[model samples]
Target chain A: MARPFVPTRMEEPITANHREARPSGAVDTRVEGVVANWFPRFLANGLDYLDVTRILDAIENWDQWGTTWEAAGENYEKLGRDALAAGHSETAGSHLRRAALTYQFAQFVMTGDTEARRRIHLRMADTYRTAAPLLQPPATPVRVPWRGIDLVGYLRTLSDDSPLVVLIPGLESTKEQFSTFEPFLLERGLSTLSFEGPGQGETWYEHGFRDEAYVDAMRALFAWIVDRPDLSGRRVALLGTSFGGYLALKSAPGLPVEAVVDIAGFFDLKDFDNLQPVIRDNFAHFMKIEPAEIEDVVSQVDLLGTLPLDVPVLAVHGEVDPIVPVEHAHRIAAAQMNATVWLYPDGTHSCNNLHTIVRPAISDWLADRLAVGA
Target chain B: MARPFVPTRMEEPITANHREARPSGAVDTRVEGVVANWFPRFLANGLDYLDVTRILDAIENWDQWGTTWEAAGENYEKLGRDALAAGHSETAGSHLRRAALTYQFAQFVMTGDTEARRRIHLRMADTYRTAAPLLQPPATPVRVPWRGIDLVGYLRTLSDDSPLVVLIPGLESTKEQFSTFEPFLLERGLSTLSFEGPGQGETWYEHGFRDEAYVDAMRALFAWIVDRPDLSGRRVALLGTSFGGYLALKSAPGLPVEAVVDIAGFFDLKDFDNLQPVIRDNFAHFMKIEPAEIEDVVSQVDLLGTLPLDVPVLAVHGEVDPIVPVEHAHRIAAAQMNATVWLYPDGTHSCNNLHTIVRPAISDWLADRLAVGA
Candidate 1:
């Protein structure tokens, strides 16, 4: 018999629609109290996740995402042992593969090292081949086209038909970041899809597409996924990481997304109001815009303004992040009523060891919503 | 009988010298766990402390600390309810007076604002007369020479028998940042001393001393404080913020400091390997060196290498700080086994909300040592 699923402790109840419209008021107080009480153990269990998040947040804002990816990969591998010991076999396997793939992606981004990326890709192929049979349906590769560029992605079938979760890679990231978890979900009967958008992996420099084009391409990808024979008419859940987090939030309203998750995502393109000069200058170059233009772009993509999100949203942020401020997460959560915001006192952009803490929570949430369709 | 000073639950046991030698291990995992859980609640407890700390950190790092004294005064007024509730009455009074004095100091630094500075000084004098007794020694005017120029400082004394705690303001800061806590300490039978060190408050333009000379002046000030009869040759605890954190760490070996606390301090200046460009440029100019030269200067002041310190040290950092990365704090903790380190998961540079959590810990540590001294 399968083990009964245990849900993680409820983090402040999902913000109801009525609560979102009003000032956060006493709910914030109550939630904060809960957080303060359990922060240390939460942190110890989540340090690696926090470290990865911090590194990713820094990379997204600083455009040094490439360098930190390697670091994050190493950390993920280190935490795998703990995950396996805790009986989270699926989580452990995913993290190990993610670690390997992240290192490959990092090398590719940092040095434009194609051979290193290919080596990792081969390793991923082997891992996936071994894990595929345990899943609901064999993982299928799909080619997504954006601005005459072809991007590769994997689609997994669900045991109970549910909304498709489309995972977007950060700038220079590939579909591999999601490969670790795809099989776990497929085995659990949850359909999932992950792809590399423009300016990432094989699409940007390889296909000559730029950053701004990604938002539209993501929308198109969602449309394409819905039309697929196996996933026809499915609602989509978009999960983004770091730079991808920003892209995911920005793209959510434009697509037929039922829910969205931004992990250490940026809400505005502008540098933080109190940013040090170094950050401001470096970011200006990364965004290819002047300091004066940042505010204008930020205004356009301000997550504080409702983007007509009609589904549940989840935002995870690191507390001590120097790159993306936790305020960004607050703003996003504040704007969405059906949002479940989980702040890891010691958690960062992407979940690592702490992922275990949030993993059950996320799976439970997804399971509850997906069960509706079932 | 004075409540027997039962330590708060937040206070971790001080392990033996070996535990101190491995400071990271010394951190009570239990306390960290508690903090992690309670973080959100701790933050909502009116984030006023964070605001205050930011203003103080800013003032301390200001190029002309004296000029911003008025702002400090304003902050004191703003902090009224919170400070009083926290038992920081003396700190409130000192900050108000310091603000007025800082305004005068700012004038002195502004090149053509001498007359304005004089007028501000007169106002400060009046404010001091009213607020001084609220502090320990009552405010008295004193002049210290720096780089052949005389700079003014306001001396407030606690009882001569009390343990002396010296406050070192950062760059442009005056003594006003400690105003809220100063009087509170005095009332608690702790002697407090605050000064605007060189390149701060009155010393910057007034003495034609740039920021580079701050370490020397702080050294001199520490030496002078030790020799004073009021201080009774007691080992002083030095609390430093931002750039002042750096200065305090540097001065640790030179001064017979009993304890040192650094908030958001940097370890290696050059290790800001991933800094945003604007900040890097600004810091470079402030340090009067090229970016390439940062590595060399970092070697001289690397707090990690300045280890085996005879004195107790506490390094506190915010994980999400945009100015100084949380890793800096981790590196410091990793380097020195004798240092006590506390990290706020969602804290930013000088964010006030963290104070509520940290203050109790700080008070307990100070009281423990002072009681032993008695």
Candidate 2:
């Protein structure tokens, strides 16, 4: 008989920011923070109901949270393998997707044990790679040549003639989450290519996060897109969510993109002190510097009056957003010569509270701008 | 210039049940009872964010909640029509679907007003019929001949040779909600046909809710399915949600089906008193009786040694289901000689809490049982 599934992570030591205690300068109240951080995933089918239940059950104390998620992920991954062996590709895809989500959540908000975090991250990427091919239409893996390294991406297409839209994920987010957003664009006849650039996903291990790394990497990705014979688009739009939104706007002036979509993205680093501890720490880790040094690094980041005037822009932001304030949206929109701004009064970070409206609207805008299928 | 949209409903009188005060025995504690009741609709894209926000802003003390949704719905329907005129079929479909959702919510819990409810219901059905054909794969409207009347359904097909699974919606739910569930089955080569039978959708106006109407309608639907040349399948399966779970299992023995999938359905009416007021009221409205008479009507509902022994079964239920008790799953499973029961410990009504796991598992089970792709 197979041995019982057991996660092999060493014990984490006690720290000042225990799960029970509220971290200093937390963006939201504990309950809201917990729900807001994970509820979107549940809505996106990134996390299963059972996983949410387990997390909710251990709401007050979360010392075992990482280990619990890791074990569940491993078990789901095993199930996926078993289903694949049985020639049930659909079932395997479902299980593996869930496994990837679980693995991603295993390290969510966890800042300890770099080796363990890396192990889980690798497992997530591997699981996603294996499962993406089994999905309907299938996601073809891409390796764009970078400086002495390679940026990884997944190209999901309905046809070779379809227009391309490059997706940029934000801090602490991976391309795996784009499964939720891909279908909307695909249905509109726009193929999507989402990748992990410098300081994002697996590439983060090689190149530490810099505020400018995102735009630089996007430029390299655009270069790669220009050369790909399989991809059919002379000019592509860049869509960035959260912090990636900044990258999309920043790169628009430099790249051969027809349009740019920035959703709940930051325009200035002036509000660095206002961010939640978790986000601040994650950004600092990506910058390979202490939290204190983050302000100085971010001070150099700004998009006021820097965006290309020719590029049509769609910017969506929530007034009540805790991470990137609503002012960032105003700044970006003001700087752009041609821009459409959608401000949600009761929206959270990323305008997630208004996803049903914004997602379709964004897709419509992209399709219209790209003249996809025309 | 295009004429501005205007709703035709007159002003409503103040009622005992306002937005702030919960009707006796209401479940949720929020001031916005109506919004809380259907917030998930917005989350699922059944309703638009702007519409929902409009409703919430005017929700301090609603005297015309039904009219509010109806006006919002009419505005969206107008938008849909305008989009269609502009040669944007995809946009038209989305708008129409959202319009249908808004119209559905208009009369969701308005049991006291029958004429308004029927009018809104007709609008919902009409909009869905128009939008269904615009969707990818397209929904072909099917009218199965019933006793002196025609039962309405939408046949969503991927291929002519794919297996068929008929979907049954529960109280206050419609085929529109199945948009989320159908893709899973279709991915595994099983076409879906979601319909309104007896006390549901368009059929409800013709034949008011009768305890036996669901089974009777299913019988008629099966007969039609067997004869349709456009659809191919020797035998079909029935999958039902909420109250329809009872209908699916109850009709399984008599219908010419190969399998049944019951998600969070009731086994017996013994626990009728434990239900929430809104659900009980809706049931009463469907039955064309008073809330006090519902228990007597439901008392006739039970399944003991009634399910077929030959057909395989899949039953999913939430342990903490607010509407149907977990014991119903136990009783239903016990009665069936071959049954698989998945009871979620911390699940809500319909095990919606466990949708990621339950949806895929049910799809796999149905595919395996009917040999859909084989």
Candidate with maximal lDDT: 2
Question: How accurate locally, in lDDT, is each candidate?
Answer: 0.53, 0.73
* Chain B, per-candidate TM-score: 0.62, 0.84
Model 2 superposed RMSD (Cα):
7.3
Name model 1 segments beyond 4 Å from true: A1-374, B1-137, B206-212, B271-301
User: Which candidate has the highest TM-score of all?
Assistant: 2
Error of 1 at B329 (Å): 0.9
Question: Model 2, range B163-282, lDDT digits (tens) per residue?
Answer: 789898888877776766887888888889988888787777678677677677788788787777776455589999988888788878767788889988888778666777766777
TM-score for chain B in model 2: 0.84
**RMSD to truth, every model:** 24.2, 7.3
- lDDT measured at residue B103 in model 1 versus the true structure, 0 to 100: 43
TM-score of 2: 0.82
Q: What TM-score would each prediction reach against the true structure?
A: 0.37, 0.82
